[model samples]
Target: MSEEALEYYKAAEISELQDGKVHSREVDGELICLIKLDQEIVAFTDNCTHISGPLNQGEFDGCSITCPWHGARFDVRTGKVLRGPARQDLYTYTVKVEGETILVGLPPA
Candidate 1:
């Protein structure tokens, strides 16, 4: 890892999150959501665009996440707000892999 890259949290692993499961993690004080959809890895912000609800507790479809509080849906790969009440998209981080570990890059400070 480069000197500057060390400041952020890298992808830990290719985690196996079951179908309909929501995983929330905090990286550098930023809340992230890791969702496993149809055997694919998708990441997004854990905060809802509407009412700031906990998206980590939301329901997961193939590539869509439904917010628990207001039932807002978003696309994980593109962070696009699918169904609303919410018009703002969630922030996305880049992901990489190092050996058996998955690496995700955080925005530069």
Candidate 2:
């Protein structure tokens, strides 16, 4: 699908996130992890690619998040695989801030 076809859904309030922290939210039935990295907001699928570990529960070390279950590491910004047991990268979502709200873009249904 084209980038314009994705729908942006409100995921959280900008004020709710603090620098270098990760928060979990459910948007359109999808589990998403919202991170505030260097004042920018980033979103990723909450499940780890290897074994479905809850990424929201993982550890954020400023640049990457380490999956609690298997220690898979993924970059918070681009969701690139930084370290593995996971051969796949985490799914990333586009983020936009409108006033105090944070919106996450998802593929259209």
Top candidate by TM-score: 2
Backbone clashes for every candidate come to 3, 0
Candidate 1: C-alpha RMSD after superposition: 3.6
Clashing pairs in 2: none
**For candidate 1, lDDT tens digit of each residue in 1-109?**
4545644465446654565566787777788987656655566788999888898888877678889999999988899999999999987666655665655677667
TM-score, one value per model: 0.80, 0.95
Model 2 worst lDDT window (10 residues): 1-10
What does candidate 2's lDDT look like per residue over 15-43, in tens digits?
88888888999999999999887768889
RMSD, candidate 2, Å: 1.0
Quote the positional error of residue 36 for candidate 1 in Å. Answer: 3.2
Clashing pairs in 1: 11-102, 11-103, 11-104
Per-residue error (Å), model 1, residue 1: 19
- Runs in model 2 deviating more than 4 A are none
